[model samples]
Target chain A: MAVLLLADVNDGALATDAVAKALSAVKGLGEVHILVAGTSAAAAAEAAKLDGAAKVLHADDAAYDHGMAEATAALIVSLAGGYSHIAAAATAFSKNVLPRAAALLDVMVISDVTAVVDADTFERPIYAGNAIQTVKSSDAKKVLTVRTASFNAAATSGSAAVEKVSATADASLSKWVEDKVAASDRPELTSAGIVVSGGRGVGSQSDFALIEKLADKLGAAVGASRAAVDSGYAPNDWQVGQTGKVVAPTLYVAVGISGAIQHLAGMKDSKVIVAINKDEEAPIFQVADYGLVADLFNAVPEMIEKL
Target chain B: MKVLVPVKRVIDYNVKVRVKADGSGVDLANVKMSMNPFDEIAVEEAIRLKEKGIATEVVVVSIGVKQAQETLRTALAMGADRAILIEATADVHTDIEPLAVAKLLAGVVKEEAPGLVLCGKQAIDNDMNATGQMLSALLGWSQATFASELAIEGDTAKVTREVDGGLQTIAVKMPAIVTVDLRLNEPRYASLPNIMKAKAKPLAAKTPADYGVDVAPRLSVVKTVEPAGRKAGVKVGSIDELIAKLKDEAGVI
Candidate 1:
């Protein structure tokens, strides 16, 4: 049996971190085949080789330029018949496309998987990252989405052979008219090693300056809860929850968060969780490795000062 | 222009769900249920549009059991013109997938032919977040997921979406599906007068067959289990001990 990694082209590559982690997680089980779907299949093939993929399946088409989820899902479903299991990074496109394909194929999809126990068994977070659950898929074909932050990006090898294959696109489906990519030079939240999140307790968007300061000090990315984003304390890009980006970082510092389960679903997989809240009994402390019971007004500034 | 808003009834956000011993599903015995918080935002946005004269009528739709009508009523009380409840006795809480629900909504859209469709970006319960996009795909209509801002032009709608990297602005033709994000708008509380008006408002009830959609579970739950409990660590009184523990035990330093 072979493990097929569905490479998302929107990120311009296999999301190297997700590939490395998935490859590392299932090292001894099966040969890893990285499938690249894009206009430039050769670029994706070269990138996949850097992640230690044994073989690269390149599906190049002009219709793929916009990264339409429907067309992408259709392609994956058609090609999925060959592999025992399919995996992709839990990015926005993967989150929207893969499950629909799995449902179309009448198979089970295990999402945001952090570990692979066996061919069919895996470990993933259920309630945000507060609780980890072990799952076993009984279906003949299994689909899984991996959290890129959980594993390291595969080191680049010198080169690999690429095989080009032409695939059909469903033009009848709706196409992406335009992509408004976020303009940011900072590390992407899903791939960041350190994340600093704020909550409604921050008061206003101006208060995010302090969070940004500390994040800059640690070279970390900034995140926010649904409460903070809804309250207009921060931008939606900074939001973290079941509806937002699912992230795993080495160090996650949550400031002024009450730790709602929905919010926890996004960042619970971090290696070290530190929560700072005036309310000592906040649910965030339940999962935090280091808890600071104080007003964020005082603690955040002091953290910036100390760092 | 008629506005269509789809709402879902889910466990109250404040309620802590417990998995059943048999792993069949979450134990919902006597647990309080409420309209999904994001759906409330969608309903609010539609009502605001109607009030602003951007829309002439607002129709609320929900797909679930009879209990879901309570949620539709909540929407009606908040100023929706009418309510339609698609009745299903099955455990929608378990078998409910986004695509199945979207297929049902597509059928309703065919009959209603509303000019605008709005839904929450995701329901707090399962967090599938695919119905709006799936509906858009099935209908071949334009879509704006995770919408934070929306404005209507002559024949198109401009939406600003909240994506992982940042904000994205997309323009889609009329009769598009727009999913509400958290920051979209603040939902208004139901006034006493509106609450009274909702009691007299018409609520039509139907079944899955009425819409000609299959509500089968495309994805089955192999099992539902509680997360592993984290071990409690000792609290140190001094920063030095904290530093020592961090370096020796946690290994961060």
Candidate 2:
């Protein structure tokens, strides 16, 4: 049985790290085939180079340009007959697309899979990572969304054969109007080696600059507690928590964060955690590898200058 | 136009869940249960649409145990016109799979043909963000997920979605599904007067059999276990010590 791995395309190129990480998860299941469905030939070229993939199925079409769930799900369903498993990176893009495909296929999707115990069995986090549930799917075809952070990215070395796939009929349900993504050279929050995150205690929107400056100094990504994002101190994409993006990096720095259980659910997997807050009794200190009882407003500036 | 909002009853967000000793599942006994936080935001958005005259009525639905009636009343107290409680499972620990829930909701949608179906992006309990998207697929409707800003314009909706990179704006035709994000709006608390008024509001109870959708589990739970906890680490005296430990001891930076 072969596994169909969907490759994520971004900015007319392959989302290399995301696709590689997703590939790592499915490679263990069976013969891995990468599906590159977008308006980019370069993305297909990139997918054809992933080491473990046996083949790259490329569908170059304008219908897939915006990555609409309807179009992608239709294409996946059209090609679902041959594969035993259909998988993609558990991201917002795939999160919106995969379940729909699963419903259309009359199967259940194992979302946010952290481990592949076997072809039919898997492990996933439930209750915001408070508990882990091992699930075994009984459906004929398995649909999955792989949590990219749990596995290492697949290296690019082997050359897999590229096969052309025809685009399916568009559902014509949604349209892309505009996307407002603030350009930043900093590494993405989910994959960064280090993440410097702020909380509501960081004060207003202007005071948030201290956290960003520290992240820049450390060459890390900027993140925020749900409180900081809800308070308008940070953008929605900057949120890192149970409801937002889950990140597991080499080093995670929490400044002024009280470490609510929801906040801890997202970052507890980091190898090293650092907490700086005026409140000595803050719960964040409990998990931090290095806890510094200090005011973030003053400590952040000093750390940035010294670094 | 009418708006349909689906909510879920889950363990309250404030309580820290504990895995049962036998590995069956999280201990739900004596646990506080409430409407999922994201679904609360969804109900609030539907009510706002009704108040703005964009919608003529707001209907809320929940598919779970009979006690989910409490969750529906909460939505009614918040300003929903009515509710439907589809009692699917008797066991509290048996969480209904998203595929079944979506199929049942599709049945409900066919019966009550609302112009829009608004729901939480994901329930906080299962953390399975699939129902709304699956429902859209079964019904063949447009979907705009992770919406931070949404406006109804003529026959279409202009939605600003929170994506991995940043915010994305999309135009979806009517009869769509919009799963709300946290920043959509601050959900309002039920007032004392509204709480009193909610008891008299219509709440119809049904079963999964009524919709001809089986609530059987397709995925078997092999085991449930607590996630490995992080060991407590040392507290540093100052910033210099912290940076030194990260660089020298941890080799992270």
lDDT of 1 by residue, B1-253 (tens): 9999999998887888777788766766678999988999999999999988999999999988788988998999999999999886656455466767888898999999999999997776665566776777677676667788988886688887766566656667778888898778889999998888898999999998997877776445556677656543444443455445656777764
- The C-alpha TM-scores of every prediction are 0.86, 0.99
Q: Please tell me which predicted candidate would have the highest lDDT against the true structure.
A: 2
Model 2 lDDT tens row, A49-105: 899999999888888877888889999999999999999999888999999999999
DockQ of 1: 0.27
- Global lDDT scores for all candidate models: 0.75, 0.92
Sliding window of 10 residues with minimal summed lDDT for model 2 chain B: B230-239
Off by over 4 Å in 2: none
Number of the top TM-score candidate: 2
User: Which runs of model 1 end up more than 4 angstroms from their true locations?
Assistant: A1-4, A10-14, A22-33, A40-43, A50-54, A59-63, A74-86, A99-144, A149-160, A167-185, A295-307, B90-94, B236-245
